[model samples]
Target: MNARIEADAAFTDWMQHVQAGMEGTLDAYLPAVTEIPARLHQAMRYTALDGGKRVRPLLVYAAGELFEAPEELLGRAAAAVEMIHVYSLVHDDMPCMDDDALRRGKPTVHVRYDEPTALLVGDALQAQAFAVLSGNVEEQYAARQLKMLHLLAQAAGSTGMCGGQAIDLASVGMTLSLAELEQMHRLKTGALLRAAILLGACSGKHLTVVEQAALEAYSCPISLAFQVVDDILDATADSATLGKTAGKDAADNKPTYVSILGLSESQALAEKLRNDAHKALEQFGNKARRLHELADLIVQRKA
Candidate 1:
């Protein structure tokens, strides 16, 4: 595996640029701090604006940039995807789900506020996300934008992230094969990551079948590598660094790549996945540099 590092100042600068743009958009979409339903709106803003890596939005911008997509469309597309991601995290930390108390180095929604407020916050964000993506766009890209909405909806519904979380809840304390584990993560983690790429690409123009197939190739391994790294971090990193409970997977008896494959093999698998992601993007050459850098970040991330 190449494992090349783009550790230059430029890489950090680009990441901040994307993060800042999406962060500002999110703040704008959220209800005002003193809205009529002030408490619910406050909970929503608290979770959405608190802090996160915003990796999914970055992927949207990067892939859209590949086809010279319109900045207006791309910005909306990124914001919509990020809203869904934030909603998922809000519910995931609720009492019925992972029941986490801390997230992103702060109190989880349900922890900081009451449980009912947290529930409504998640529900509102999910609804608001689709509202952002429902408008018309460039004539040539109109159909593609609709397709992006469907992709995100399906990714969030029973067949995608929600379905994967169901599997996760059901599989606790039960043994699973590597293939089964991959299936779970594919829906849970991979679906959103893949949608980010497709939604971004769709924001620009229609991709030839061959070009989209290449994006799929890149997204599959890239998504899996991300989860593998998460598993590794859960085992090795601290709560302060991770911004969440460390070693919670083992404590909950949840199955993870590291749990089944051991630390050494999981690390090796992450490297292999990164290599596959790069190989899939070889056709795009320098145009895919952001994606290639993202794949490396997913695997090499410490938290």
Candidate 2:
């Protein structure tokens, strides 16, 4: 197969594996939480199972595969990453935040259930992510697992996603510098992406300090590229194709790359970032092909 086709196939297989792993986690864990009300459970399951691109999970598996990590172990890590992502989305769509009524081509948790239930579901998903990590049977390295948990907590907590969200809310309708926009996205999206690759590498115990550094460098550009593409799609794509409301950022008066840099310049920036991301993986030879392709796919994706 051609490199791009092979990469797409690998990504498809990984997505199926991730979806199965996530369903398994829900089956195993949801029943154990007997105290959870049925409504809350429904809300949680509704949003959690809602279809997404599952990019973060794919990154986890790809990073692990690059290092020859075991499938079972990588699946566990992928599940954990996805749990965190779903939790963030549920909370982000609440009325107090983005107030989004739709996600993944369906009503958001708040729209389906209520704000309170949505909040609770988000909380439960976040807690369940740590629980899943703790329950990983294939984790032979205690120190590595602990490190992975720590990385996730930091990324999902005040220093990362939460912080970015706070800044984003504060910046509504206000013009921000390119530096400010980059700062916002680095914490909002980059931290988890960086952690996804790092945790996968850590799981395999195959990452040299230099390799870690290279991946970190690669993540920065790709993360920004991801956000830029999102901005572009928000302006151009509809909710049905995007799986979320289109033109929302502009409607909400949020500052975006498109607003700051213009559409053409934002696209050029994404291309430059994609090139830089590919260059960061050059040292790894063919083993890094998927990673490079992933960068291209992120910028080129319609949604």
Candidate 3:
């Protein structure tokens, strides 16, 4: 095989390993179905376990591996970030939000269970994420772990994902400039993704100001590109391919890259962002191979 094919195979192996390992890690960290609130616990597992691309956790592992972070620490951080991501999805699918009935090819939490259970599931998962991240903190890494916790909270709270989501709700049926759309997604979609990378890097050691800046620059384009590709997929792909309702954004009349830039332009924008993501990692060289591949995957994925 060619070198490109070799690298793709290696990355496929690594991706499978991480995905499988996260299943066990999350299962162990989550509350048991037999826990006091059995129904709520079951719902939490239903929404969180065994679904989706797990891109956030994959980013966590890739960044963590780049920094030579400990495997155990990386696992905790990965599971924590994924829990937060899943919680956001749960809430986003509620009638109060997107009102979707399917996610990851399964009935949404609110659809499978009741609205109240879904709400509690999201709440419980968020709390569980912090609990897992905060548990078993070593004295040597206490300060660093504390910072990780703070970063996650900031990412999930107002001024981050929640703020972006609020803007999305209001933007329906309204026209927004490209700059405005970028700003909203920066918080809603990019914040947690940025946090996933930073949290993984922080797990290994302290980051120099320069290193942090480079990582920040790299994250900016990749994060936005992820959303750009999502817009493209939503516009063109089917629900079976996407594992969720397709054309929902257009159906809801939400402003998207496709709506604003046209399908071809939106696709070109995604490619440009992917290139930007690669350029930002030039300084990191081969150490960022996984990150480079991830950037490609984000833009090139069919769903």
- For model 3, state the Cα shift of residue 56 in Å: 0.5
- Count of steric clashes across candidates, in order: 0, 0, 0
lDDT of 1: 0.90
Error of model 2, residue 299, in angstroms? 0.9
- Residue 169 alpha-carbon offset, candidate 2, angstroms: 0.5
Taken over the whole model, the C-alpha lDDT of each candidate is 0.90, 0.83, 0.92
Candidate 1's displacement at residue 255, Å, is 0.7
lDDT accuracy of residue 242 in candidate 3: 91
Q: For residues 146-232, could you state the per-residue lDDT of candidate 1 as single tens digits?
A: 888899999998999999999999999999999999999999988999999998998886699999999999999999999999999
Cα lDDT for residue 246, candidate 2: 97
Which consecutive 10 residues in model 2 have the weakest lDDT in total?
Answer: 25-34
Quote the positional error of residue 166 for candidate 1 in Å.
0.4
Model 3, 171-198: lDDT tens digits are: 9999999999999999999999999999
lDDT of 2 at 245: 92
